[model samples]
Target: MPLYKTLTPNSQTTVKIWKITETYDDLLEPISLKPENMKRVLGMKSELHQRGFLSVRHLLLEFGYTDDDLFYDEYGKPHLKDGKHISITHSFTFSGVVVSDGIVGIDIEKQREKIGVIAHKFMDYEYQYLDQSDDKYINKLIVIWCIKESLYKLFATPGLSFLQNTLVIPFTLEEASTHAWIDYQDKKYRFDTTFFEFEGFTCAYALPS
Candidate 1:
């Protein structure tokens, strides 16, 4: 089990990251999935996605839960049966989950220069502080993208716009954390966001504050 990292953001929240190095059969050997999830995983066309899905089940075990303890809403946000909040994300070789007493979201993304091509799609207020000429431009954009994605998962609203509604407050890479807001339907919600990099991938998470 390559349980790569664990973070206790607070007393009530736990974030666990896994490095996906096991074969599909290896991941399946220790755990049994619920019927629906088994069917869902089997239908996935990509082996990477299958492994990511199975890897999450292992993370659930680390949290003292199981596939039967999780479910998805109409909007496709995952939830715990006991009422605790949970958010999950996986990209390439990394997968992560955040479990908290309050609403929370997590995202992991590989650092890629190609993000610069679509930066305009999701960034506006952040551009004021971002320096494209700097070496950290791609890192900063990945953080922003993860922040917005986490916020979207946290909010779980039907039509929230990453560009128009989500706002990531400025912060340097050294800060490791910042704040963000979501302005939707005349109301605003604030979150305290944190991010970190490991093995060329960045993981960002948000907790409602």
Candidate 2:
């Protein structure tokens, strides 16, 4: 499951996911990293985080990109040398990337009951339809969190608060898609969002509408 999945959201965008089933040495063996990234990875204190970082490089290769083609801004959002938009995320054993000609974002998050304990920290508007008593409560919360994170990565604007600035329109798992908005600085930006569950995690992505 090194390359767990791939998505072509549109002709101009691509998404790749990797399941970190490889050891650090196994993943590093095939990668060519610039000195800075090599040091960053070497300084990681957790093997899980280290493997997650390397797995993303593998995801980049799946998209026909090399580590050299990617760079980050002061806000920590990723950019491509070719000018395509790119977003990266990894949680536990899974890592994902989305690259596009236009603004785009993607995220992967493991569903956990703890998310419910802090849902209020990042939720608004969504409360109108959410019911913690439902069996799918935690699942829905994870979806919203991942969706907001995707939008946040796309926005990458400082002072944008997830609880106050982003909203995921009402949706059910079966629908597989929904409308999301980022209301920041008095500007309301809409996005076409999609999500799916794999194993125990949720992955969501957003593109400007």
Candidate 3:
């Protein structure tokens, strides 16, 4: 059980992270998944994905929930049966979940330079503050990307564009937190974004503020 970290951001929210080191069989041993989730896990082509899926179940147990208490909306956003907001993320060997009283979203992404090549596809206003020549460019990009992803998951609205609609305010890597806005269909929403890094991976989460 590589339960890496647990964080209580507020009285009504909790975040849990898992460092996956268990084999597929080992991970499958403890939790009994609902039939649909079991079939979903079995149908995953990559064993790494399977393990990440299973580790999330363990995270749910840490919060006293199970697969039976979870469901996905048409947009694929996860929901708790008790009506609490839930957001989930996984990347490489890490997986995480955020349960909150308000709308929330989370994402974990492996830091890599490859993101630079496609930065323009999902970035617009952020370009004003990004210095491609800076040594921390990749890290900065990853944080912004994760921030947008979190907001997207929180919104769960179809046809939203990361580049056009989601905007992350200027912030330095040292800040580790910032503000973001979603402007779509003549409506504006705001969220507080926070980020952290571990073992070459970056995790970002957001909550309606």
Candidate 4:
């Protein structure tokens, strides 16, 4: 019942969203973070980390999988017993998952009032189109951030930064739908993005070109 939207980027991939609420059954269970994930969650600022994990677990349940059904390999990528390509994300009260027979990715981010200081780290050519001085800037930034995060999750690479890589092409944010492309090792990827208001955050998912 958590699916918010479904998208088909190509004949081979499908991406879906889930809005995890407090009523979600898994929210009450004690978190059992794996040692590796614990390293990051334990050091995180608390609420964000806990909410993220709780959301992810609930999303798995929506798919008929449980917390015990997930395992992370040495590369830090999560592996499901069913062997599907998966990506997980949570921001504020929203969490999302993208699963595909092929490679997939997804991301969700809290719509902050201001992302001023950190903008430079993620905004590149997309900056020219952005009216950072405008009141709508934070929402615009979240759109770009979610798209980049999806691409990162899709590739599962370590050193790529949104500012230097992830090309969002060009699109109008007018109708809550956008298109983007990413070039990874000479391969071009096409992504279709849609922004939805969910639990006070902006959520997006992407798949192969």
Candidate 5:
């Protein structure tokens, strides 16, 4: 029953986020799933993942979509039959869906100190301005990770390197928005990414800049 927050970044895009506060059964009971999706969710070993999967269906319902309207390409990027662009992301306690008239991506992640431990793997250019001593360092890192993840979802191409091919422009938490680029396969792309934090989690969405 928790529909959570909804967003309209522009006239053509909508973002919905669900805060999971229901038992697996409660989430499962309300929505009808495609047979394959039912089998897929039931087979998930982690209850967290099971709930995450179900919550996305609820988000889809908010957008007036059902599993039948969704499909995955060979690259595993999700698509809507009506030709609108879409991307989805789920974390430990939240799930997000972004539907747009143009290309878009969305992600939600729990903000934690551990992100700094793995920052090296996905971050490169931003390191020049990233200082560990800053109080907002963790928050900034989470935003960068989410931004890169959103771009990855939008690009949907294999061999896209977060470290080598993607870069997040410098910004403070107060700004809440930045620009990023994807340099892959000898082509370059740009996106405008925005992020916000809630209940200890960070969620970001990307749209073509």
Candidate 6:
């Protein structure tokens, strides 16, 4: 199954989402896995993660690239062989990839009640403006979680607490997009955020300035 969604935030950036339903083998049948990657593949916990890898591989191919077209840095940040910025994400049943010449980050999370329990740990400024009018609080929390996680990925810095370092400017739950910032040291990184509901999941992608 190929679940597809495209986001065009500006003339300079575009994002594509692919939801994969096939088992790991089914998705990897078309691609060649390296010995190192194959070794890592043997450690995957579920078919979900397996397919996630395959789906991202397919994504690279779609972008006119191949497996060898990507490389990971010491921090595990992915960079295109041609020097484009890229980010990858995967959840229980869905996986996503976003690539751009600019800084980019992508995240997918299953909408769940449990995320609410840890909201305070990552939600500081966000708590001030979260609309409480809706009874679906979990949905609201999931949206915030996705946004913060996307920020975390974008920052790629260790020891930055979500609640302490990241802040979301308030918005209605029904809104299609939100804005957020990361204050790390003296530099403030701002992001234009967008979230959408799909297959019991909330997916968020952020581009940095």
Per-candidate local distance difference test: 0.95, 0.93, 0.94, 0.69, 0.93, 0.80
Tell me which residue pairs clash in candidate 4: 190-209
lDDT of 3 by residue, 92-192 (tens): 89999999999999999999999999999999999998899999999999999999999999999999999999999999888989999999999999999
Q: How much is 108 displaced in model 2, in angstroms?
A: 0.4
TM-scores, in order shown?
0.98, 0.98, 0.98, 0.76, 0.97, 0.92
Between candidates 2 and 4, the one scoring higher on lDDT is 2
What's the lDDT of the predicted structure labeled candidate 5? 0.93
Off by over 4 Å in 6: 131-133
Say which candidate scores most in lDDT.
Answer: 1
State the lDDT at 107 in candidate 1: 97
Write candidate 4's Cα lDDT for 3-78 as tens digits: 5666665565555565555542356354454566556555667665566676676667666677667887766777
Worst 10-residue lDDT window for candidate 3 reads 1-10
CA RMSD for every model? 0.7, 0.8, 0.7, 3.9, 0.9, 1.7
- How many collisions between residues are there in candidate 5? 0
Cα distance off (Å), candidate 3, residue 149: 0.3
Candidate 5 lDDT, 146-171, residue by residue in tens: 99999999988888899999999998
Clash counts for the predictions, in order:
0, 0, 0, 1, 0, 0
lDDT of 1: 0.95
**Model 2, span 80-171: residue lDDT tens:** 99998999999999999998999999999998999999999999899999987999999999999999999999999999999999999999
The superposed Cα distance between candidate 2 and the true structure at residue 171, in angstroms, equals 0.3
Q: Any idea what lDDT model 6 has?
A: 0.80
Q: After superposition, how far is residue 81 of candidate 2 from its true place, in Å?
A: 0.4
Ordering by lDDT: 1, 3, 2, 5, 6, 4
Tens digits of lDDT, candidate 1, 29-104: 8998999889999999999999999999999999999999999999999999999999999998889999999999
